[model samples]
Target: MQSDKPSFVFTGWHMLAAMLLFFGTIITVNFTMAYLATSTWSGLVVKNTYIASQEFNGKAAGIRAMLSTGIKGTLAVKDDSIRYGLAMPGDKPVLADKVTAHFKRPVGEHQDFVTELEPAGAGVYEASRQVLPGNWIVEIIAVKDGETIMHEANRIAVTGEGK
Candidate 1:
């Protein structure tokens, strides 16, 4: 005589459930680690890049300092307008609330001229006028918080007359 006994056998559903749980946990953990690593590395890269870029720009600005003063590179002329660049010294960039550019005839009366308000960002302004150009003076005034601050690079001349 033999005793009746049953042996435990895993069904397809049991194997499927176990596989699903194992893979689900693995995928979730992988995603979490990836997210954290990416966020950390991206932040570090941004900070480092900003510092390095400022250093490079400082070096370039030093070389460019001479061009803004002497002949040839000092002037900014256009067909119908003129623009000049204003930069703050050191590593920091210029940020002004208001910038004004005034163009006038150097030798003649200053009545026949144009003045324009410049935007922020780059701090440049241009006022166009239809006048026979021989020699004109340009004045740039930058203001912040209702007070006049930086002003330089004056006495720019417009050379040729228009057709």
Candidate 2:
């Protein structure tokens, strides 16, 4: 005669198995997310933080001075080009003899570019570029006497298709 009965009691092996599965899933997910974040990150906001910090005060003062002088600018996107316009208080639209446009993508540095604008009219400048539709940080630098006389930086919304 043999006794046949199913055991329904909890055991150490069962507890160990459940714990292993629970912790394994958590560890796997954490590692995967960490890998993806590091791989996509560009790192470093500035090459030398100390130098940038040193120049920060002067830059702020210069911007304030330029603002009071009634220097104004606008940026627009056209067909594979960016139309820039400058408004100065004097006779000419551009206050400086040389004007350059600098574009930077906030998310990454690889998309950063610079182009010198050709005078389209008295106050208008035209520069052609293949710009992707997103947030763009623009700086219009006006140079005179071999130095940057005035600069304006603003964020612009770019629409339309991107390549």
TM-score leader: 2
lDDT of 2 by residue, 38-135 (tens): 77766778889999999999989887887887867777876688787777766457645778988888777777889988788877788777888889
The whole-model C-alpha lDDT of candidate 2 against the native structure comes to 0.80
Q: Candidate 1, residue 48: CA error in Å?
A: 56
lDDT per prediction?
Answer: 0.57, 0.80
Give me the displacement of residue 96 in model 2, in angstroms.
2.2
RMSD of candidates 1 onward, in order: 19.1, 3.5
